[model samples]
Target: MQPEGQAKRLVIVSDAWHPQVNGVVRTLTKLREQMEARGFEVTIISPADYRSAPCPTYPEIRLALTHPLAIRARIEALQPAYVHIATEGPLGIMARRACLKNNWRFTTSFHTRFPEYLRERLPVPLSWSYSFLRRFHNAAEHCLVPTQSIHDELAERGFATLKVWTRGVDRELFRPQPDVDLKLPRPVFLCVGRVAPEKNLESFLSLDLPGTKLIVGDGPDLHELRRKYPNTVFAGKKEGETLARYYAGSDVFVFPSRTDTFGLVLLEAIACGLPVAGYPVPGPKDVVGASGAGVLSDNLQKAALGALEMGRVDPDVRLKGFSWEACADIFESVLTTIGSAKVLKSRKVKSDRVIPAP
Candidate 1:
């Protein structure tokens, strides 16, 4: 229990934030809003607040170039009841180091499958990457995963202290709008994610499905993909009502990524009364779950066509299991477990390992 009128402070250190429209950003934004509504004071430290450089290949993602000492100073000043490291980028690394130096127990979230992502673009072995990631996350009191399948997979890969931290969708904004006129062919199949190789966009692009194929996001592979698949409609990035309208206009939401920890877009698509089409992968497998909101198969082309005829499930009944409020409840529980009576007492720190000022 906390003292009256004194809000419990929670500091979130993430490498991903605004100007970058991705699942991680959306999830954190909603989580912050919901947590604040639940009486927790949330502070976010991200690339948006620091000097940053464009990430290689993925220039849309900005990497924080600030020094570890600067991050240490910021976190120390906050003196948050709990600290959460949300990504494996520079900011997260620095925050982890700061916690170690101060002997502070913090939690981390494994949002991306960096091992598979690196292997797609680099020559490094997956084992090497997983080894590094394991060391990074093992330092935390808890390593939050988005799905049970991912938790099981990481556990097999030697990740410890794993906990399931699911994601949610904004139903009010994403619910179906049968009146929106897309003017495209009937039974349109839509893919709404970064147009990158790791996303396996080519799999969806090369499919022999009927009607028009539309892509609703942009990325490094956009130009090349548009050139290769000239027939596909590239609608660039969308948000709020525009994004929701697109989701409603489409007949099926196609997700091609096999490495995603959880496809937040899946919930959004289903919430818009659109069935999903994807492989029997972790994200879709965990989300669809025989909800009759999606058709998952090894043959994406077949699945796409199958999803076209599938009747739209009532978004309310289908999406009842997901909500930002519920997601935030779990997050606050973790913060309370680490920040409350369990280990809230200050511990003696080693004076020799002091973090220097930048």
Candidate 2:
């Protein structure tokens, strides 16, 4: 056990982590940084710490082949005050089992829409996958969702103790550069995220619109999509200011993924003063919702064209309630409440908004 006066220890067990570049990895990375700054000793247990094999189809993501006993032993050695399982992959499953076997309470977050994603790739029924997911998350003390739409959907599916833990953006990195130019066509329609089937990249690439369609990330389908859509520009995977400039330079940000729980790219795009165009789906619905920061429609072409007309606006007005500080506060509150109710009540109140189950 950790001696008194040591920072409150937090063990975050996730299947998603570097060097994979996706929202889950980004969110968890930021969470650790923010939590540590707030005086928590954050320990991340990922595939890098154990023997792993690449996930089938998605080679970039490695699946841990760790035994439950090994996971339990590691957790015991760490002596964490709280454990948060961030995914439902092999590592997350083993960690969940370890916590349960020891009668330890742990919290979880719903990051990916695996049920919809699996159905897009395989012949798996949504019901079968959701049943498995529902069971996986419901085992926890609370399941944190990114948006109210997702929370409602999961609640309808019978998930209990649900809470809303929204995401944040790095405004300093993704701000607008008025003079920056991609040197592409007049209205460059940009889409930044994994180029996977679940992302529905084809929906945007296949659109009949003006200007260039640019993809700014890499995934399993990068090669195939490149071969199929020769005209579209694939910028591969970009990071830091390079990634932000892609958003800043673009005229309209097009998000075609209907499966994403929350599109971090949407926040990134808006932060860069770029208007968004997307299917009136959960992600866009939640982020763009009456903000006038973007346009959403079933007609992808129409949405893109409409967003292009809106031009650039001050992002500060649209991104009022989003920040890494607030995100960490909500996360810490949940963990503290689950780990020790007294600590949660004693901490400075950054946010009092916790979504309870309907």
Candidate 3:
């Protein structure tokens, strides 16, 4: 530590990025832009790209999973002031443990409700998994959450030092153009995100209603799912203008994930003026309750049917109070605070490293 005023370097480690088509990747990418603009030197450490929903529009970032001892040596050579571990995977665990032993502070993000997601797919009860998750996150000095609801939920379950830095939607890309109608038949139902079993997408496909199902993403389950449900139009992964058009064209957006800590995609659907219809769970619960954004239910079929009866809501209602600019601004503040603290901490560490044991 060379005095409190020295500049600090920030490194972020996560298992999700680039190829992963989810909220954390989007948030971290935007946050990187914001942090760099604020004069912080940023480094990202992530695993090699893996299979995600494969959004065609956005280019993937360059990443490496675990570079041997040589890669670790290279990272240490850079001398990062703080390592911010954002996921609980092999790479992230290594980063966190290394930082902890060396007296360096690290922060983490709670994005996915992994316990619930894994439980829905596997055999373990959520309670046992939650305790395991709590242990993993408790290692961090500060763990970030995207909503007050998630924060409260985690806190109640014994997670500590929770913080909030919400996800943002790109308003420019997802602007509401009510003048341009999709011209689909009345009561069109749209479902975005992965077409996998975990997404609980089968319910949306079986919505026994009047309109066509506009399925706008792809996953491993796409082939069988498309074949099983001829009612759905498989539009694969789309982005930018294409995605906005898909959202704009639909009358209702159907999301079926209860395991999302914050459904950034839910906000994206709302941003395009498409009223949402999904289960009354975590992601939808937060977005809908906060913005009165869309119709929701415990049953997807019920929600879809209820949406048809909902008629039309003012588009401006759901579109209000959301923007990517605002999300980036909040992220800037968090990085600034962390950067300042890291500088002071580095100085103390340096001072201690120099002094001999008394």
Candidate 4:
């Protein structure tokens, strides 16, 4: 590790970048800020820097069409102290290859459940997808996950070298804005995130709960969901102060997703003094964690109603353990470990090779 004041370069390769406002993007953006604050120079290799094609069914997420040689050249030019692949997309694959061809050790992060996502849209077997992802991640020195539940789930599915890399909420930006006028009815049960099948929005929308059901954010399922649930208000995509206002304006933040590795929106809700209601699943299970911040139940209706009666918990205290600073600290430690592994491997190669006597 470098001295306290020393700055080291970190090159991050991710297929998911700007114009895509998801958890992975949010997490990476915050992570880069925190890392830079801690004396690290960060370089991002994203689709923005190369020619790209739109991902089918998800045109918002552009796929990099850059050549392998170009990727290697760019990475080599940066001469980063460490390389971290932030997604399992095209750019990540190229970066992995570059590192492997140069015999350089790199770290990777599993931000989404690709196997589950794929199975949702295709007739592909979960085992085949998991097997494919397993090979991609297994090549890395370490694979960072968001929660223990995810770490455990991935481990069960044959993922190795896993580490728990938790996420943090931007409390300053997501704090309670009780003064904002949502003009919705009392006990407004709001769900924020992409309105897609994987998010289980129908489970919440279909709930026969009293009060206005508000949906914040947009997705492919927006039009269909809007048509199906005419009573529920679809506010489309919201960000910055507007998003926080939506969070604070609501009584309960209903998270119906069963697939998210970590539902970052839950943290944002808490940060905005909104309680959560969701299934007792991985993402919500870890975040709520016995803190009276939210209610998790098998019955979505029961959970949503239960959350309305609960008072908002102090996010500052409830989420005292989570912060970008700490997240960055752990990330830095991981980079340091990878650097050490590189040094050890270099030594091993020298020690093992038979040199001719001169």
lDDT winner among the candidates?
A: 2
User: How many residue pairs clash per model?
Assistant: 0, 0, 5, 0
lDDT of 4: 0.85
| TM-score attained by model 4 | 0.92
Scored against the true structure, residue 238 in model 4 reaches a CA lDDT of 94
Candidates' lDDT values, in order?
Answer: 0.85, 0.87, 0.70, 0.85
Please give, for residues 1-358, the per-residue lDDT of candidate 3 as tens digits.
3222224467888777766776788888887887778666888877653232322222342334454453445456666655677887666667766665455666787887777667666789889988977987887777888888889999999999788766777877876766666666766788888666678888777767787888888776889988898867888998779888888777788887766777777888777777778787777877776777677888777887776676445545764655666665655444422333323443433433421112
When sorted by lDDT, best at the front, the candidate numbers are: 2, 1, 4, 3
Residue 204 lDDT in candidate 3? 72
TM per prediction: 0.93, 0.92, 0.83, 0.92
Candidate 3's error at 104, in angstroms? 1.0
Looking at candidate 1, what is the lDDT of residue 224?
90
Q: Where in model 1 is the C-alpha error above 4 Å? A: 3-7, 336-358
User: In model 2, what lDDT does residue 11 have?
Assistant: 93
Cα RMSD of all models vs. native, in order, equals: 4.7, 6.1, 5.3, 4.1
Q: Is candidate 2 or candidate 3 better by TM-score?
A: 2
The Cα RMSD in angstroms, rounded to one decimal, for candidate 2 relative to the true structure is 6.1
The residue-by-residue lDDT of candidate 4 on 57-93, one tens digit each, is: 7878899998988998898777566899998898998
> In model 4, which regions exceed 4 Å deviation?
1-7, 336-358
